[model samples]
Target: MSKKLTKNKKKYRDKISHNKKYSLEKAIEIIKKTNFVKFNASVDIAICLGIDPRLPDQMVRGSIKLPNGIGKNTIVLALVDQERELEAKESGADYVGLDYIEKIKSGWTDNIDVIVATPSVMNKLSILGKILGPKGLMPNPKMDTVSTDIKKSIEEFKYGKVFFKSDRYGIIHSSVGRISFSNQHLLENIKEFMRKIIQSKPSSSKGSYIKNVCLSSTMGSGSVSLDIKNFD
Candidate 1:
């Protein structure tokens, strides 16, 4: 840490005790105060779990719709029947139809966030697994991305539904909202995200399920550690 800190960084440093664990509410406030970016920064959360990632049964993964929608729009691509193309688009899908398969095969998966496909189209998509699987774009039933109801699935993701999966290091990372959002909205989103994580704990995991939680923005002021007990 250099003494030549910017006025904003100095203000944040003086206001926050880095070694101290803050309550969720207090953490959100601190995150808001510390953000010094010109653009509206995304409020991000990282939760460290106690489970071993090497164990298949200990994996934690699921999706949740935050009470308040995430400030960023979720760009969804819906793969459905020709008859359902209109329905998918009406449901808020950014891109719709099986025609996208040809585009996707040409290595054109840019600016797309989530992909929802009906079961009937999954077979056609199977051949493109080599292209989509590595990018985590392949639709799966577990995440509700592969469904008979393409409209419902697309709408859910279009609004706020987000999937979270523990990394190889046992940490789950996701954005709650943007710095421009009200602190209360951000707090509610964080609480809902934490609740989802708690609910997704694997049965095989033992000891402390969540070891640590941290909050930060897309830019500026770094991360603030939060008291895990507050989540319980």
Candidate 2:
């Protein structure tokens, strides 16, 4: 029985490894075959674009229905005043309350992915600038996290109102779609995102703002490159 179990485990591991290798090779082939102009793939790719931080207000923030939804399950925390609290509850959020900011500060906000709050709560929580700020979970005005429209906000977030920002490498990372998504649908979503990024370029930035872009499966090896020169 022990020998059989060991053999089964080895088989499972070999199957996973083989699948990963094939996926990587296929991704490279897709990248090479697709030209910059007609290089649209059925898979959605992560896009990075340059922006001027000075004009922070111009950043785009809103919900979009990704043709293929992001695969990972998200836990949403709705922070609202007393009146809108009930509305938030009805909107299908995992957790809802005005005091959520305090809970977060107290280190109770584990396994939470998204946060929506009213403007008042945002002002109060701004004092926690250093804590949530580093995690990219900061409820900001630009991302529509602070809003009184509880229903609209909740619905939007459920779809895909992804909050994106640059990392230490100047790369803005956000999940565009799931691995199960069809290549065509993913490509369309990627194109739409790229179009928005290009349109959002600040007028103050003189040189080319969109430096480069690449896409990869999460936790998978090697990224396929995409050209942003004429990403319309």
In terms of lDDT, the best-performing candidate is 1
- Cα-lDDT of candidate 1: 0.88
- Candidate 2 per-residue C-alpha lDDT over 1-232 given as tens digits, one digit per residue, 9 for 90 to 100: 6566456445433434322323333443443333222213223455445655546543434444455556556688888778888888888788988676677778776887778787777667776678777676777666777776878878777776566555444456666765555656566666666666666565655676777676665333335655454363
lDDT measured at residue 23 in model 2 versus the true structure, 0 to 100: 36
Model 1 compared with the native: what TM-score?
0.94
Residue-level lDDT of model 1, residues 114-158, one tens digit each, is: 999988888899888999988888998988899998878888898
**TM-score, every prediction:** 0.94, 0.72
The Cα error of candidate 2 at residue 177, in Å, is: 0.6
